[model samples]
Target: MTPRWTATGLSQDLPKGVVMAGHWQGHDLAVWRSATGRLQAWNDRCPHRGMRLSHGFVRGETLACIYHGWVYGAEGGCKHIPAHPALTPPATITVTAFACVEQDGVIWVAPADMAGSPPAVSGVQPLRSVSLTCDLAAVLAVEPALLGQDILRGTVQIDGQGHDVCLLVQNNPAGLTLHALCGVRANKVAASHWVENLRRRAEMKVAA
Candidate 1:
């Protein structure tokens, strides 16, 4: 029904040392890949002038603000300020960072420290990501068992065609974000077409 990166579509996204604008729940996120290929998530807003950190560049393990050039480490601590090169950045000059983990190529972000692990979707490789205008319930209404859970929670699916789909059911602040995956043997072209079809159908179903 839907594909959230935490479920399946993560590994296919930007690689290490890359930054992308992503959203979770309803919060704007600065999703970055560190030099070591580790994933980091931060509030997209830069502390200096409230610029979007996602638009910023990734230098080594840090993400630099595009506007004022404030550089932040993977832990979200301010490391350097371009305007005042000699001054040590105050420890307080840090963006609110989320705890992000990349396991089996899927990146997961938690607002606070997560006591337990994210939901399971092993044995599937990433395909791609998508967004929709539908909610989790709307998606589940169409395919209840798609979630594999008793409740209509967010779902992760391995399609009959062997493609892995990670459906992220977000609130309508900006609709939904879906991530799809496939087994190593899955056909990339077919998975892409299938995902696109699902995206259009899901968006239309909820929109109507």
Candidate 2:
């Protein structure tokens, strides 16, 4: 399959020093933000002992594996080994890292060798992210208009006014997760309610 920058979550959802598990295409990924507010993405597996990096903690500019406390730098190289604090980790001790970026209120991740930047969107702010127990096709089946490679645009009506909303979708094994963004003139409450309704409809389709 062709690789592209996939939206993972809203920028506000991932604060500094936070780590979470994510998936892109078919690969399990570890997504985290350093103390300095930079986004990092890895294969979610530590080089040593094969522990999951997503279960690890972020300290300063490095991520420490919870199993053995082996710390890896932003470049995915092991920087510190707690068991051997006095010994420098070998240069070969490293984990696979990917390209990560945050723009337009969304966190994007791509393959390590993928080129180009995340698709751009303007004039909208992220309201929230929600997970649906369905595939991307089912999500589009609900409204059809909300179909796009990166950001999907649709309308939500509130107080008799049609407001524009954006949906940034990320496909995973469990289902499809989306970040909801609202236009400056959009109704936040209505947009949120619309998301809930969409989830129910899409998931209902998946179940049937």
Candidate of highest lDDT = 2
User: Per-residue lDDT of 178-203 in model 2, one digit per residue for the tens?
Assistant: 88888888778877888888899889
TM-score of 1: 0.80
Where is the poorest 10-residue window by lDDT in model 1?
A: 149-158
lDDT: worst 10-residue window of model 2: 150-159
**Where does model 1 exceed 4 Å of error?**
1-9, 141-145, 148-172, 183-185
| Shift in Å, residue 157, candidate 1 | 12
Q: What would the per-residue lDDT of candidate 1 be over residues 126-169, giving only the tens digit for each residue?
A: 66777777765565666543563311223334345434444443
lDDT of 1: 0.68
Q: How many angstroms is residue 196 displaced in model 1 relative to the true structure, after the best TM-score fit? A: 1.2
Q: lDDT, candidate 2, residue 136? A: 74
Clashes (backbone N, CA, C under 3 Å), per candidate, total 12, 0
